[model samples]
Target: MATWPRREYFYYFTKMMPTGFTLTVDLDVTATKEWLAARDLKFNAAYLYLVSKVIAQTPEFRVYRDNTGQLQRFDVIHPAYSVMHADDHSISSLWTAYDPDFTQFYQNYLADLAEYGDQRTPMPKAPQSENTYMIGSIPWTHFTSYTPLPFTPLNTFFPVIQAGKFEQEAKRWQMPLSLTIHHAVADGYHVSQFFEQLQLAFDHPEAWLAS
Candidate 1:
């Protein structure tokens, strides 16, 4: 295992090698009565917690990867976040990635906003053939729309945000998933288990609240 800071090049030349395809059913956020009773914070917190736990313990999820090469456990969940950065400025909050503590995360989020009140930065230009680059000192006027789970690759991620759907994106959306893997880490059953865990967490979110 390597605990290494990402290389600058790591951000550049970003293309993944995909090996396997495991189809999944998307759970409707409001499909069941139990979902509302569970509360929004409950599901959101649990989902973040579970994703954090899985990725922290399993390095594979962090890699832009696939598991077609090995028969190991591919049933792990990865973290995908929605960040709203625009052509002109820096984003003050990264609340979507916080794990297990919404109170602190929300507090910090507000703090960032307050401290940088009305501060706006010029948008950084993106390279040719890509959408706008959305990171750096934030613009005072750019209204932040959202920062949530990243359901797809970076190149193809923003469109979903524009459309506002993950289940539809994951299953029916035009974008395809790409993963590069050595295949030694996971397999079919593992991929199935990943979805099962997600469903279980959604079904039983009361058990996921912080005490």
Candidate 2:
């Protein structure tokens, strides 16, 4: 684990805040959708893998406070998300280890779904790991803005991301993505970096799809 310098006032101030801030933006996902469709890949799995890949490259996204109250950075971050079952219309929490390899990650994700997708009760909360982020998808609606309710105010270091429905505009497809992160761990610049990286990935899906 790595720690940020005490002299970073922004980190100190934002970490002490009662709540985190959210930013929402529309992302062009035309290339991504096309790549996935060509390979018969699951959209959610591919998108989630892209998100994890970007987060792994951004150190700020991995910064979080440990149980001992020490700020630390994780070398790897996992994803925890919700999956809906088609059988009973139930939702369940699913946690999957992050893998840079899209194929491996997608396989593991499918395995988790097959094992617990039909379960009505929420899966036991995974042990709190500062290296994990919460993710959700709302494929039913295309939204311009979103605000996520905090599960806990004390530990808002890890980010919460929600991907809304995709819309077709002429020759392009766009997705609404909302990200909530603790201001202490990152600033607007860091958020912009994430979005920029994500957009690049979407624009060139072949770069990731072949990995």
What are the root-mean-square deviations of the candidates from the true structure over C-alphas?
Answer: 12.0, 2.4
**Regions of model 1 farther than 4 Å from truth:** 1-18, 28-46, 54-80, 84-184
Clashes of each: 28, 0
Give lDDT tens digits, candidate 2, residues 1-211.
2344533654456545434688999999999899899888899988888999999998878866677877677887888889887877778887888888888999988987877677777874445444678888999999998898765445536778999999999989999999998776677888988999999999998997676
Error of 2 at 68 (Å): 1.6
State the C-alpha lDDT per candidate.
Answer: 0.34, 0.82
How do the residues 48-116 of candidate 1 rate in per-residue lDDT, one tens digit apiece?
A: 454444344444333433234211222333233223445544432222334345455434334534444
Instruction: List where candidate 2 sits over 4 angstroms from the true fold.
Output: 1-3, 10-19, 124-130
Which candidate number has the best TM-score?
A: 2
TM-scores of all candidate predictions against the true structure: 0.39, 0.90
